[model samples]
Target chain A: MFGLRYLEDVVTLELDASKCTGCGNCIEVCPHAVFEIFEKKARIVDRDACMECGACAMNCAPGALSVDSGVGCASAVITGAVRGTEPTCGCSEDADCC
Target chain B: MNESTRNTGECCQGSSTQKPVEQAREQQECTCQPEEAPHWSDGSIDTPSGRILRVKTTLTPRDHLGTWMVHWGIRRMRYKITPGLYAVGSPTQQSPVFVTANYKMSFDRLRSQLWGRHAWILVLDTKGVNVWCSAGKGTFGSEELMRRIQAVRLEEIVSHRTLILPQLSATGVSAHIVRKGNGWRVVFGPVRSEDLPRYLDAGMKATPQMRCVRFTLANRLVLIPLECVEWFKYLVLASVVFLLLSGFGTGGYSLERIQDVGLRSVLMLLIAYLAGAAFSPALLPWIPGRAFSVKGAWIGLAAVVVLIAYGLPGPGVFDNWLEAGGWLLLVPAISSFLAMNFTGASTYTSLSGVRREMRVAVPSQITATAAGIVVWVVGRFM
Candidate 1:
């Protein structure tokens, strides 16, 4: 959350304005302040700030938001790579990754 | 100075009169209790499914204590409430049903904000984790929600066909599945519990500011204590090794040599820890790099500068500048590595970005630390 922004173009966040109902659900759920409503449609105002938590996408009732979201922890990714499984955030009962 | 004293100092602080482990055990026992007797107010009501425990919407001293204990990494895993239905006020069969994690803090925050409102809180079993984390782990997913709904017989308790879930829990829950399975519509609430009032008043619609996640200075600062506590063991091990190794440079171990080396090494390790783990997260935005490793390295460099300005461990102990130079490289490297670990807890980092940063940063850190160790060893023998 520190203001140190990473690669500007790497986030997977996408919004379909045509399908958006201008409900502002995406704006209400995004912790990064990534969306803004203009002309009754949700627009990605700060795309680079997105951490890809997927809250905005899930709250989009009209199916207007989408993103590839997963745990950002490095250790968990490495563990998943070694074990040959999809990376988890290490909160599951089977994995003690954290 | 010794193990017992060090442990006492580390484990006990102001207001933390009880031992952490004991508190943790107590918390576990509290959660593990049978659900037959609910921990609610005297005005609890018995419904067709089960008893709905009426609870105060305001936070008590015990709640504050629990929150503080969690912040300090005490009883964190056991800080949960029993999963079931709870009542905030005198709600009838038609009141709104809100879903949340059983983590006491999440439950407390939600209930406390609903001071005068009558609502039904559907607590999902999250194994003591908050809503966001539990959602990411799938513990707060569709299956759990469905199970809890059936267990609580929510349909029989309320007349509504809608369930309000926190927006962050979207990752683990598929609204389509829930709707199709139970015929109950899911309404995603705001990112924060405080915004629930406005959301409810506006016909369950959210505003722009309610969705945004802000990691302000205070939020960043709260995370430092837990990080410091978690890394304290590694810090101790590193300090001991550095202290013992510092004596090798002077040919033999002497009281004065041991004391000097121990003090300086411990000071350097402390500086490295504070720079990387504590200060890095606290001053994250101001640090002049996009990469966390680079940000940590800058802070480590600042620590090195401070040490150098204070006179780099007098030449009387070491043979030459080689040992000093080694420390100059090693301390910052340690700081950088610890700072990189913060990427997991941070809000801005993405999985792809963390992967990319690790590819470049990890190797450089390994090389720098290894090279520093080699230089120190060679200087010792010389």
Candidate 2:
């Protein structure tokens, strides 16, 4: 989105436990004091602070890290759809682009 | 260059934007430069001198021809790439660092304003896609930024550790983690890059009102011509299909004058395209209701009025009206579908909010479009 929201849920880093394999990859990767190990699994100490990028998922061995990822830009989808191209959004071409 | 090496942030390279409404009322006159370059192509200087400092850029014949052409083809009917970076003039390290994609349109909007600013620009490798879409795909997120930071040696360019980002990009970059991992603090910028000057002058802080995204009529309207361009080919194809189908529906009489039907079909399509892709974005905010569909409907209605004024014809036109109405319904639904998609482009709205809107909006569109088709087919005969 590259657009900023003033309400300070500014950034957060979390792992979905149901999918997590208790891999410590995120803890190893993060530079901020955002994540900590708990019960052999990594947890987001500050969920409201997530920035919404997909780094953990990239390095996570088990593919357990999943966040509602994607740059939420409206123009991108409209641009994709207007071309008769399938939208690059979570929904189908006929669906909302975001 | 290479696909894997695309994360270098070579194309765009920037960060978050500042909100507009908040800046207008702030009353703080910034000592920065006073005239930002025009937002986009009016054939003016690429960069302006306003408090907004546009990122410097140079386009050679070499960048990405195929990719640019493809993107151009895609946007022929709608959508655009505002390439370049910008700053509200005289920017310093204290100016927030914003990031965006190299879609050209996005890049230009970000940097073309800062003539002599010193803010860090971090362009992610969306492979030519813009920010929000790229973020959704994960190309504009943390891994890419970190890699770009490493690749570009961003630390060497700026003294500040804070990297402001477009709010829509949050899905890709986890803030807390970036600070821990890259030693760079992530700040969500603004929804529109034009607001950068006002934002920088206001102590680098965004008010709650600034963060809200409104897809006003002006917002929706500007997108129309671009949308029409994006779908030009589709419109041609649709015209051929409609002409052939209407002839078939008539069984014989209208068969000989295939040219007439073809022209009419194409005209209908033009109207639809203008209404849906063109008019839709222009009339966004003023169209009515919070939902994009309603906004598009308003535009579609306006397109219908345009059709009436142009003399579409008599009962012979009822057949045209059916085509027209079908398009009216169909286009806005398409526009609404497209406009609703803008959520990813702005600072407001979250992933969950988007998902929620889609859940409700999609089913409604599906049903409406299906009905429109049915009525259209029925009208062709009766």
What DockQ does each listed candidate score?
A: 0.29, 0.10
| lDDT (Cα, tens digit) per residue for candidate 1, span B1-382 | 0001001221112134655334323322343545565343436877887666788888878789889998887867667777778888888888999999988899998998888988899888676678887887777888778877876778898888899998888767777678877888887788889999899999988876776666678988988887788689989998888778767755575556558756777877898899988999899899888888889999998877665666645542344567666767787798888788777777667777777778888888889899988886677656
Per-prediction TM-score to the true structure, in the order listed: 0.84, 0.54
Weakest ten-residue segment in model 1 chain B by summed lDDT: B1-10
lDDT (Cα, tens digit) per residue for candidate 1, span A16-90: 888999987667667778888899989999998888777777667788998988766655565668769765544
* After superposition, candidate 2 runs with Cα above 4 Å error: A1-87, A90-98, B1-100, B154-160, B166-168, B201-203, B207-218, B248-262, B288-290, B294-316, B319-382
What's the iRMSD of model 2? 13.8
Tens digits of per-residue lDDT for model 2, B1-382: 0001112322221222423222211212211122544333222212222222343443234224433543335432113332223344345546656788745666656665444555545555455556655666666777667765655455654577877776556546666667778788776665566666566678666544444345454554444444555567777787777777666455554765456655665676666666656554554445566445455556666665676556645423445566656655665565566556444433344444444456677777677678766766665665
Give the clash total for candidate 1. Answer: 4
Question: RMSD of candidate 2 to the true fold?
Answer: 13.3
Where is model 1 more than 4 Å wrong at Cα? Answer: A1-4, A14-28, A36-43, A56-66, A78-85, A92-98, B1-31, B34-43, B312-320
Best by TM-score: 1
